[model samples]
Target: MSDKAKIAVDAMGGDHAPQMVIEGLAAARVLYPGVRFVIFGDENVLRPMLASFPELDAASDLVHTDEVVTSDCKPSQALRRSRQSSMGLALQAVKDGEADVAVSAGNTGALMALAKFILRTMPGIERPALVAPVPTLRGESVMLDLGANVECDTRNLVEFAVMGAAYARTVLGLSRPTVALLNVGVEELKGKETLREAADILKQASHIPMEFVGFTEGDAIGAGAVDVVVADGFTGNIALKTAEGTARFMGELLRRAFGSSLLAKIGYLFARRGLRQLREHLDPNNHNGGVFLGLNGLVVKSHGGASAEGFKTAVITAIDMVEADLIRLISADLPDVPGHEEEAGAA
Candidate 1:
C-alpha cells in the first residue's frame, strides 16, 4: 500500500458491484501494477469474490464495512448511514489522508450531495462540476457540469470555465485551451440572458486566459474546434446522452448497410478493421466515466452501466488527476471564490 498510488474504491457501489469491480480492478492491475486500492464494502460478499482470485488479496486492502449505499437511497440517508457504508468508508479514507483519491459508481446524486457536504467546495468554487472527455472529429474534447449541479447561476458558470480550463491544461496537456460556452447558437444574441452573462464573464476573466471562443452548437462539438465546453448540468447531461445515443444509432445503421448482400459483405471484409476502430472511437462505453471537480479533494464518478473495464478507467483517471495535482492548479487560477477564501481575522 505504501509503495503505490492509493485509491479508495467503493466495492459495492456499481450496478454489478462486487463482481464487476473486482474483475475490473484485477484487469487494471495488470496495466497499473503500482496502483494500490482500498476496497470498502460488505466483507461477507466481497471476501468470497476475493477468495475466488487469490491475486486479489495481493493487489488491494479491504476496508471492511457491512452497509451498502443503494442507488435509490436519499443523500442524507446515505451520508447518515455512511458511517458504516462502503462508499462512505471509501470517501472517508480520502478525507482522512489515507488515500490520494476516491472512486465510485453508486448513486450519482447521493455521491455528489455527500461529497459537497463532507469534502466541501474549494475556496473559490460555487459548486462542483462534472467534467468528462468526449469523442471528437479531431480527437477528443472536454465538457463540464454534466449533471452535478442541474441548476446554476452566472457565477457558477464562470467558475466552471476556470476549472475546466485548468483541467484541460493540466490533464489534457493543453497550454491555453480553447474554451467555448455550450449554447444554442453562435451569434452574440443567440442564447438567453444566463448564457449571455456567462459568456461575458469568460471574455474578461483573467484567472485563465482560455481562448474564450464564443458559443458552440450541438453540431460543432464533434468538430473539436474547442477544447472545453461549459454549460449547466441539465443541458450538459442532455447533450452527453444525446451524443451517446447518436453514436450507437450510427453504428447499427452502418452494420445493417454492410450486411445487405454478398457485394456489400466483400467491401466490409476489407474495411472491417477500420469500421471497428471507428465504432470504438465513438462508443460511449469507452469513456463512460468522469470526475467531480471544484471540491478540495479528488472525487470521481463512474457510469452506473460501467463494466469492469469502465470502472478501471475511472480509477486510472482518478490516479492521474491526483498525481498531477490538478485541484491545486485550478485553485491558483480562481478569483476569491465564496468557499475558497480564508476568513479575514477569523471572521
Candidate 2:
C-alpha cells in the first residue's frame, strides 16, 4: 500500500477489456498495495476477477460498478448520453474527489472528449496536451501534444514548451532541461511562420526554467540533446507512430532472420540476452502511455491495443504520477506562461 492513490480504471475500455485489464490491475495491486481501485464495469463480471487473485488479501481495494463504455462510442456523445458508462462514472469519481487519478485504454477520442468535459482545463490552460515519455539515447524524453490539439498558434506552442519542461523536470529529474520546437529544419527559418514567431517569443521568455534549444529534427529526437519536443498533435502523433512502427518492423525482420535456421537460432541463443535487453529498451508499450498535460490532475492514457504487461506499466506510471504529485508541481513550476509573462504582468 502506497497511500491510497485511488485510481478509477476502465475494466471494459480497451480492445482486450475486462480480461487483460483485470490481469494488469491484479499485477499492479501486488506491487503497489496502497492503490485501491474503483473498477468501472459490471459487478458480476468484475467481482470474479478481484476474487480470483488470492494474493489480494484486502477487500477494501476495489469498487465495482455495472456500467461499461466501449471503444466504438464517440467520446463526447458517450460522456453526454452514457452517464452510467464506466468511462463517465470513473471520471465522475475523480470529479467528485473519490479518486486521485483516472486510467483508460479505451476509445482515445472519447477519453479526451470526456476528460476535457468532466475534469475541465486548469486556470490558464486553454486546451490540454497529450504528453508521452519517450526513451532517448541518454534515458527518456517528453513529446508533447501527442493527439490533443492539432492546429496551434505561437502561444499554444509556447505553452506546450512550458508544460513539457515542467514534466521533464518533475518526472525525469532533469534540471533546466532543454526545450525544442519540432521542425523540418534545425534553423529558425525552417518551419512555418508560427515556428519563427514562437522562436522569437521563447527566445526572451524567463518563466520556463528550460534552456530554449530552438528547433529539432526527427533524427535529433533520439540524440538526447533536448528534453522537451514541442509540436501540434498532428505532427507529434505522426512522429510517435512513426517511431513505434519502425521499431516493430525492425523487430519482425530480426526475428525472421534469427529464427530461420538452427545455427542462427544458436547464434541468437548466445545473443539472446542482448537482444532481449534491446527489445525491452525499445518496447513501445514500456513507456508508450502518456499524461494529459495542462489538466489540474494527472490523467494517463495507454494504447487501445496495449497488452497486459503494457497496461500494468501504465498503472505503474499512473502510480508514479500520483506519488510525485506531478500536477501540483506542474502548476507550481510556472508563475506564468512563457512569452506571455511580461504582457500579463504589465496588465
Candidate 3:
C-alpha cells in the first residue's frame, strides 16, 4: 500500500450509475486530498464526465469495462461473469494489491458473493459479516450481520463479536468497546442455544479488547446500550429495516403535524431549526457505508439508491478502514480467542 489509500470503485453498479459514482468521488477528493481512486466502468461515459471535475480526474485512474452487474442479478450469475463485470474487477483490484480497499453501490448479494470468491475469508473466519455504524441516542454504535448470512452457528456469532469489536475500536475510536448479543431478552438463558453459547465464550475470553455485557434486547440497539451489537443476518436485517422505517414514519408525521392548521404552522416556525437538525441526524446518507468484515481485504457497500453525498461517505469509510489497518487488527485479535487455533486448523 502507498502513503495514499487507493480505492477501487464499481462505477456502473448503482441505480444512478456512473454519474453518481463520479460526482461522489469528486466530492470525496476535496475532503481527502491524499487518497486516489481506481474507477472501473465504461471509459466512453466516464471520460466525458471526468472532464467536468479536474481535481477528481487528476486524482483518479479510469479502468474501462462495459460489463455491469445489474440490480436484479443473482449471486450465481455474478460469479460466472466476475472477471468482466465492474463490481468484480474492482474487488479484483483489492485482491491483486492494486488498491487498499473497494467500494461499490451495487447489488448486495452479488457484491458479497464476488468478494468472498475473490478476496476469500480471513483465517479462522467461516463467513464474512455485513456491518454498519448506526446513529443512537447515546452516540454511534456498530451492528453486524445485516444480511450476509441468514443463519449462523455459535462459532459464527462468536467470530462476529470479535470482528465487530475490532470495528468499534477503529471506527468509533473506543479503546475497549462494550459488546452484547442481540437477543429476545437480556437474560443469559433467554434466547437460542447458539446465543447462549456465543455469550459464554465471549465472557471467558478476557484477552480480547472488549467488554462482554451479555445479551441485549432489540429495542436497546437504538438506545446504544453497547458499542457493538452481534446477531445473525435474519434478525439483524429485520431490526435495521424496522429502525429505518420508524425514522421515516416519524419525519412524515412531523411534517403533517406542522402543516395541519394556522396555529400549527406558527408553531413550526419556532421548531424549524431543531427539526432541521433532527432531519440531518436521521438522514440515511449520513450513515451509508456497510462494511463486509472478515474478508482478506477491505470492501464497503454503499446503498444502491444512495445519492452523491451518500456514496462519498462510503468512499471515505473505505479510506478510514485502510488507514486504521482494520484487516490487520482483526487478524491479530482472532488468534487470541480460546479455541480459534483449532478452528483455523480445521478450516
Candidate 4:
C-alpha cells in the first residue's frame, strides 16, 4: 500500500522454481534495496530455498500454497481451478493492493488469461497487449502484441501505438518517441487495411506524445527505424521468434568460423573481447521480461526457462514499470473513445 514497490512472485512457476526464483529475488534486492516481495508457493520447498539467501528472506514474506498452474494447463482450466495457486495468488495480491506488480514465469496463455480475468482491462482499452524491448541497430525499440491477440483491428493497433509509446518513454526514457506500423513496405499504399487505417489514425491523432513515422517494414525493426513498432500478435510473435533464431544462427556461424583453423583460433583470441561484448548485448537474459500492457494492474511475464540472471532482469523490469507509474501514464494518455470518456477519467 505504500509508495515503495512490493513485488508478488509466483515462486512455484518456471523450469527451475524456488531456487532460481530465490536467486533472482536476491539479485533484485541488491539492485533495488527498498523493494519488498510476497512469495507464493509451498512453504516447505520455499523455506529451504529462502534459507540459502538470507538477504532475500529478510526482504520477503512467504505465503504457503501447494496448488500450481502447470506449464501445459489450459488457460480456462487455470482460471477455473487456480484461485489458490501460486501464480493466481500472486496476481490476486496486486488486485488486493498488497503488491505493486506481479511477476511470473508460468504458462504464457494461462498467465494472460488469469491476469486479464483478475486485473481486467483499463478503461477504453479493449484487451491487454504483450510488449517488450527488442535490440536494434540504433539502440532498442519497443514492439507490442508479441503474442497476446493474434488478430487486431485498427483501433487495437492505435491503442497499441499509444501504449507502446508510453512504455518506451517510461522504461527507455524517451520523451517523444517515434511510432510506425509494421508493414510489407514503407509505402502508404502497402500492407493490409488495418495497418493503413492505424497509420492514418496515429498520424492525425493530436493527443498522444509521439511522432507518427508513417510505415516501417519488417526489415526496419532491427534497424531501429522507429521507437515503437505496431503489429498484430501473430506477425509480432513470428518476427520475434525469427529474430531470436537468426541471432542464434549468426552466433553459431561465428563459433564455427573461429573453430575452423589455427589462424581463425588466433583471430578469435584477438577479437574475443569484442565478441564477448556483442554476446552480452544480444543475450536474451538481459531482456527477459514481457509486459502485459493495458491491464488495470501491471503483470510481467518472465521466460519459463530463464536463468537467475534472466529472472533478475524481469524483476528489474517490473520495478521500472512501477517507478514510471505506467498505469497512470497510460490512463492519462489513452485516446478518448466515444461513450468511454467518463470511464476513462475514473480509471
Q: Write model 2 residue lDDT over 47-95, tens digit each, in one string.
A: 7776777654252345556666666787667767766778777777888
Off by over 4 Å in 3: 1-3, 343-347
- Best-matching candidate per lDDT: 3
Off by over 4 Å in 1: 1-3, 52-56, 207-209, 336-347
Candidate 3 vs candidate 4: the lDDT winner is 3
Query: Using Cα atoms with residue i matched to residue i, what is each candidate's TM-score against the true structure?
Result: 0.92, 0.92, 0.97, 0.96
Weakest 10 consecutive residues, lDDT, candidate 4?
A: 335-344
Comparing 1 and 3 on TM-score, the stronger one: 3
lDDT of each residue in 1-347, candidate 4, tens digit only: 12379999999899988688889989988878889999999999899888988888988999999999998999999999998999999999999999999999999999999999999998889889999999888868889989999999988998898899899998779898999888899999999998998887777776677788889888989998899998999999999999989999999999999999999999999999999988887888887899999998999999899999999999999999998989989887874433345666775
Candidate lDDT scores, in order, read 0.82, 0.80, 0.93, 0.90
Clashing residue pairs found in predicted model 3:
none
Error of 1 at 107 (Å): 1.1
Error of 3 at 169 (Å): 0.5
The whole-model C-alpha lDDT of candidate 2 against the native structure comes to 0.80
C-alpha lDDT of residue 38 in model 2 = 76
Q: How well is each residue in 1-347 modelled by candidate 1, as lDDT tens digits?
A: 32378888988887888898888778777777888889998888888888876675677898777788887998778767665678877777888888888899999888887788778887757699999999998788899989988888888887898889888875578888999888889998998788898887778764464788889998888888799999999999999989888988988998899999999999999999999899889866577668889887899898887988888778777777877788888877774334333631232
In model 1, which range of ten residues has the least summed lDDT?
338-347
Q: Rank the candidates by lDDT, best first.
A: 3, 4, 1, 2
Model 4: residues with Cα > 4 Å off, grouped in runs: 1-3, 336-347
Error of 3 at 215 (Å): 0.5
